[model samples]
Target: MVLPRNRDYFQIFLASLSPMIFVVLLLAELGLEWVYSLSIITLCYLASFIFWFKNGTKPAAWISKGKLHIRDGVFGTDVIYKDRLESMRYEIGHKRAVAGSNAEEAEMHILVIKMKGFDEWTLPIKDLIEHGPNLRLYKFIRDNFYNLKLVKK
Candidate 1:
């Protein structure tokens, strides 16, 4: 089965740039004297949003035909056959929120894959507020690939 990547780019973009948006609103409320700053920030956010929108929605990992196809990075993917896998594990991680902001820290769930002749590969199963950890994906891997070692993080 193929499992799509869980991250939503637009949501992440908005969350990361929310403070700038808030500042723009605050300046507007105070009568728009900070037009220069507001405009600059707004333009920056817009450009960033556009970039993410175009480049996001990728990094998908899945198992098929006894091989694992996983995203290596922003624009790379690597394939490892079942025979080459050493172990697979998962762990919970915390993502620190912006300091002095009202935002709270978020939990991140990462899946780690270890191969015989390659470095470990980590994939984010769940991150930010867009989605929760994909326990289903983990369980699927464990249940289907019973020959592969399941290790603790």
Candidate 2:
């Protein structure tokens, strides 16, 4: 249960800067004053940078006798027993639109796991890390597990 490396700085920079670019473009079109527009864009850029710096790291992975442990944040980590897992499946092509328009969309690939006596938990792997590594991890879990009951919605 080895977690992959964090995304590089260039990727994070582009992700943080794209929204500021959009805001600047919108302000220009609306004929807003230069100081006000610049301030807004600057504030947004800084906030995005701070958020990315704080939450973008991959957590440590540990495998005990019959359980898997993963820590993705500062709060409570996830502990899953190998025997209790009932099913695991990849849910792809889920779309979410950004505010203000239907033209801007975010696609997600979620990995949902159902445990024996526990309610299902869906992890949004796409937003946390790169797609290839996430897909590899999902396949690894699916192959190593037993019965996999895919839920239909």
Cα lDDT of candidate 1 equals 0.61
Candidate 1: which pairs clash? none
Compared with the true structure, all predictions reach lDDT values of: 0.61, 0.63
Instruction: Give RMSD (Å) of candidate 1 vs. truth.
Output: 6.9
Give me the runs in candidate 2 sitting further than 4 Å from their true place.
60-83, 86-114, 117-153
lDDT of 1 by residue, 54-140 (tens): 545654556788886655434556565788778777565546454687877655566677879889997664433322445544565
Residue 63 in model 2: lDDT: 57
TM-score of every prediction relative to native: 0.43, 0.48
Candidate that scores best on TM-score? 2
Q: How does candidate 2 score on lDDT?
A: 0.63
lDDT at 145 for candidate 1? 59
Error of 2 at 25 (Å): 1.6
